[model samples]
Target: MDSHTKSKDSAVCHEICQSHKNKVIKFFCTNHEFLGCKDCIALNHRKCQIDHIEDKCAGIGDSEEYKTTLIELEQKIKAVDAVIKKATLQDKEVDSTYDHVIKEIVKFRKEINDRLDQLQKQILADAEKKKPEDKETVKKVLERCTDLSSDIKNFKSKLQENKTSQQDGQLYIMIKQAKSKLNMDDLKNAEECLEQTDTLCTFERNKELENILTTHNAFGMLKPFATPMTPGKKSVSVKLTDKGEINIKTQSDRNGCQITDCAELSSTKLLLADYNNCKLKVVDTQIKAVVEEKALNSAPWCIAVLPEDKIAVTVPDKKKILVMAIAGKFSIIRRIPVKGDCRGITYRQDHLYVLCLGSKCVLTVDTHGKVKNIISLKNEIFVNPYYVLLSEDARYFYISNQGSESVVVVTLQGDISAVYKHKDLSAPLGMMMLDDGSLLVCCYCNNTIHHTSGDLNEGQTILDSGLQNPWAIYYNHQDQEVYIGGYCNQLKIRKVASTV
Candidate 1:
């Protein structure tokens, strides 16, 4: 073909060479995303790999990799479109839910108003009943005073007339009779009647209702929620296999330190609570080293990561939860005082769930440290409830009770759903629920990690050989890795193998 005809028939690249417009785009920089002529490539992209457009396009359309990439992109687009559709429907449901809640609130308000009206009416009726008797008492006292005043006036007139016209004996007899009729004690008693009826009845508020309004400061709480983005099930079966372990030792530790809790902060960084060292350490998994450590006032038992680089650590001995801001180091932003010894803690949405070791219950509190509710398993007494974990759906929580030697599944409202116990599983400590409705629990006394279904029934031992006393276990969904910490000095990470 002629040169001009060949150039016309060739795929005319949209990316024009600014420096050489006459030299149509001939080469592409593989290093940087740009199409240029030979001169442009030599000038601006000298270090970049330059390839001719014809050679770069050779067999690309027919290649399996290219075709697969195209198919994957198309599938992703469809998935995103499906998500958009689901989200739109969820938005409509949100509106419906809002309307329903508003109606329910209105109904509740009306009920409260009616009850208050009834209380007011009852109080008014009681006050009304006292009014008639109070009026009668006042009327009788006034009548007695009027009659006594008339008798006194008559007696005084007779004495005055007798003094002028009668003998002294007659006057003296009249004076004695007048004195007998006028009793001073009766007059004094009548004057006291006004004080008795002054405040016969008054309205007083119900102390219990007053306390509820003042203490809680809210009539009702509305917790709004949105649908979460569900992840696709793994194509492989998730199996626990040991990757490696690192012994955690802080500067204060002459020997090794007890790692109580471990949480994945990032893809390659995990936060560890060194109980013996009384410090919180962030470890770099890739480097197998502690990047930063912060000294705490009390020994850290458990930790929950909050939003915006904040972490809540439970100090059982102190009976408080300290919220620390984690940037380069830890700074105590707030301290929440708890009545009982705080143990395992987790943050979900804007609230924190803390397992109270002393009370043997789980308490839910808001971000501002306000107690929302206390959850205790019904008909089951927990002796030493150590760790508590909310399910992925948040409909239930799994609590590991060391004293009871069982894992209790309780609903958010504190109703016991089921209790899981096994001869091999004793003294279950730390617990975590996986996305696929499975739980990984670490046994403190047994030094083993057990895998069970969401109901905490039908499970097998996953790890037991290398652990001394596994106190805490954390599963990283993004990295598909499990981190174990406990009474031992070493922290262990294992690969989560997925089976088909």
Candidate 2:
């Protein structure tokens, strides 16, 4: 036989199982799509139904299953090709789109400059119109004053002269000219013009507009986001699954527990910052109990987790940040004192982002407690940002503003990307990004938990009745549960039930 005929014969032959060198592979598990010998089937897939190899292979290449699979493969290929084409077009248009935006900015700047020029011309013209009248009035008054001044000198000289009626005549003529021009209109107008204080075409600049430009880096916001290329399917709505609540109140706590903030150590464990009682407690979410508790000299407002069992907590009253290691118990490693009343805090990569409620700004600090950058929020839509959160990708921040009752989205480059405001969302507090990439916000005044997309759209109240003034909310995607604490004594644990 030729070499090709020999290769075809070799391919058609059956092989022995690797598990048992002496035994030929005789069975196939259709459910698991695995081939095995008698010994292998008994040990590995005893529960799975087995088919004889020859009988399973009797599909003869024209079966319904094979035809269906071929059609599905072809459809998938077409779908992938369409996605590829769309992505190519999008990539090609990026530069042109950005160029157009640059042109628009240039156009806007020209318009502003033209308007400023027009305004400058108008004010200058007004000053020009008033200049001649004021100048003439002053000149007339100066001339009269000069004549009188010369008269006094002339009178003095004439007194010194031996004998001169000519000197007296000269003084009399000077006084006559001075008195002739001293009319009521001339005197009043001169006095009024000289006594007037400033307001001569002075510009009262808009302090608010100046502040907006000074505080912010740019006028136009450049937002970059990712969208899945897979063909259409809408979002799956979700609700809080009612697991029983955990009462965080302790014997040492004289007042009701104020859970100002919380952090997830794991899917089933959490660390709670009890602001009212000035305590930090670790809780087991699965068992629904407090695992451990630690007392603090000052109230802890927020938590930022660092690598290697380390965490940073912001103490607003002390104006300090405590770096603690939680390997055994929460023990302070170092104290970093900040300038303002730093409340809400989070960290990404090498920097800590702490929100200054009083200053209306955020401070970015390195792991070693050195300040890196200060992001001012004076010009943003939100008035009082009590809480700040860094996005998972570390590209953006979500700030909860109590004064404006809104959530402002900020990029890491310190730009306001979007502002979320709802008529019902009043005095918004803490926020957590859910597993589904939706955001859950605490409406402190409304007594509701609002869920919305990352851009804060298509929102609905996911939890309203259970929690009261839900201040601290934490979510873990692994367990898909929410651990919430608020103004009350009890800390809550709720499951997230998703429905597609």
Candidate 3:
């Protein structure tokens, strides 16, 4: 239904007014939006003065409540008006750009059409100019000669009876006259004319069209749509300040650099390798809870958590990988002795990929500890071979090589794909790829986390505030945060900014 009709039918109350003052008259009450008699006014509003109702109504045209409401509405309207004004200015710019592009498009189209018309007109004009030429007359003569020759041939055959010899001679004479009148040269010219009329030549339309479309940008959207002018959500941006007091400082027993592997098992617990102690210490991040200190027969270099919460440790010094249940029972699952030491390790899809430091190779081993593939990086130009990261699709692999001073991208076939070089990065250790396809690299020597886009350029120091020798980087898409570990005041949890 129409808005006016609907509003009137709804009969929502929006005003107030006195009935009347004593007088023998009737008047319309605009505030109350109803009619009242003089007696009714006295009975309902005895003390209220109602003289010249229209004037009184006009004096208090708008109520205080209404005035306040109107002021608020006016403010709202002004806000919208400002937005519209800005949008109108932007629209004018878009329209101007659109008009410029459209003019080029129209000009191009006209030029193309004009060229096509010229071709058509030229063809028609050429054909019309040749219409009254001697070609037609020569064609008629040829047809006549052929007809007379056919008659002569029939008459000659009849002459074998001897009675039709004179008729045959007359027909032969006619045929000879016709043959002398025939022009073989003109017939050849006629054949050329037929070719000119019937043969189809190349138009070069594509090339001509390309020339007509001089402005390349003219083909795109006339007026690119302005992004919707909506308010964005307010987000909290936290930066680590040197002013805030450090609440916690915790350390693990490194056993004089004998063991170099540590990871946060959970939010509260930290798992560390103590080589001299011949044990793996699980300490608490919050409290002094020595959760578990399991003794091992050999030194453990790296550790991984299996699906069943079992811990898998790789021992390069012992040349063996051990699997221990969470209940603290250790067993030698698969022993893949390597020529070099194992540096970094990760388990995915029932396969363990370990970075062999000295050999410059990544060893992919099955759960049974059998070496499935040895991705040789021996010949690679940059072969520090510290950490390896497989993309979510497991198609592209990124390797952080300490010796090469750059990260190398390798294919699944162990071929050197692309090398990302950054000189500021000294001994790159941890590599993490964000969901937005950006790479976050933690440089150990520099103690800085470099944020780079897909091309690895335009890097910004996203977290140079408090990191001290950050050794590893891990992204948790579930929490939309990145966790940095190793040689920092504490594990730094950073929320990635929304790309949208």
Candidate 4:
């Protein structure tokens, strides 16, 4: 049955107006959206624009709202189905993951047992290696002592016989001979060996292994995620006081450090893109030193740490995204090839929004680097196209240019929002947004960082010194520090004082 027919039959006063039980709800007030009898309309909806129900339903199927409803219904179904499919895939992944880990655990246990067995065998082999030598030394001493006892017994018998025979000359001669033939060297060797105690072999367990086994909670450790591309909503108007500078320069750097970008691996560790050096370096922020470095096939322009141990580096010359695994060390796990030379890159909702410097456009790509869509800036006075970042709501994003005074605000459809220009925004390299709706941008050539209102309309320089040609920037809210780096300058970390 139709909804209207059901509505009339379902209630005690179904089609009848609640305000006037004797009259049916035949009119719909366009202004107030009310249904009432003639007397009720005169009292309550006299000023409202009224439309008859029949007239309102005349072209319902052809109406825009009806079309929108159809589209929304299909979209909602697809959205719900996508969620269900993802959840189901995740469920299957969980089962497979358990199976894989169990196998690894079994394999690891066997490896541990094998290593322990090898160690045990080595200890036994070492003990046995010296056992025979030591045993022989003691046995030789025992054999000499037994021979000496026999000589003593034979001499006593001879001496007793000589004394009983009353032959003084013979007895004296025998005693002299016995003293001369005593074999003192043999007796001394036995006595010296018996004088000292033998040492027993011992095994000292590995302290490090013992500590790890006793103190650790899991075979593979679990850690919270690293600092994202853009962290929580932090104000750009923060005081960057002198903390210290992390010299990203290393012994292998052939040219001046052109740190195009840097990422925080954790609170204490950082990852830097050495453009001129053609290397990626892992820095120990506490020591202000580079702890690990990985050479790249091409100069790396940007670094983006993605979900679950993955990091992406944009190699513009190579025209590919070097997908790396960031664990204790950086390893090139895979490479995602793009159509054009790529520079600036950011990740959101499992897609990489990359700014292609040569093409002068932004490509929305999957984690695999397959181009899903492109946001072109070929028409605008697009300049450097160094970095692109999505807004907090992901509705729109901003792109920076090194040669232009204005920053480009773009929707997902590639439509321009505004091209606000300012002197302080000169050579803007990297851009970030603050929680208070302020945008933080790095002025590369100006050697400064600027903060503007969320709309990029009003702004001023907050930091203007100690950073030379600042190319990349990061504001860590948890540590209350601002990290800025650039050409000819080591990455500097400054303490963030406040929202002021």
Off by over 4 Å in 2: 1-235
Better of 3 and 4 by lDDT: 4
Clash totals, every prediction? 9, 0, 1, 0
Residue pairs with backbone overlap in model 3: 384-403
Report the Cα lDDT for residue 283, model 4: 85
Model 1 spans with C-alpha error above 4 angstroms: 1-238
Best by lDDT: 1
How close is every model to the real structure, measured as TM-score? 0.53, 0.54, 0.45, 0.53
Q: What is the C-alpha RMSD, rounded to one decimal, of candidate 1? A: 20.3
For candidate 3, give the lDDT. Answer: 0.61
Candidate with top TM-score is 2
* lDDT to native, each model: 0.79, 0.78, 0.61, 0.77
Residue 489 displacement in candidate 1 (angstroms): 2.0
Q: How many backbone clashes does candidate 1 have?
A: 9
Give per-residue CA lDDT, model 3, range 371-427, as digits (tens): 878888877575677777775544446788777778776655565545767767677
Q: Tell me how far the alpha carbon of residue 385 in candidate 1 is from the true structure, in angstroms, after superposition.
A: 0.7
Ranking by lDDT: 1, 2, 4, 3
lDDT of 4 by residue, 1-500 (tens): 69877654443224778877788777778787777767777787888998766545655678999999999999999999977865765465456446645766787788789998998899888888778877877788889889888988888888999999988998999898788768467787777886662635567888988887887573565343211222342345655688888778899888999888878788888888888899998888788899999997789999888988888889989899988888867788888887787988888767888888888888888887677888888854686677888776555668886666777777666656556578777788877655465667889877888876666656788888888888888767677677787886488877866563
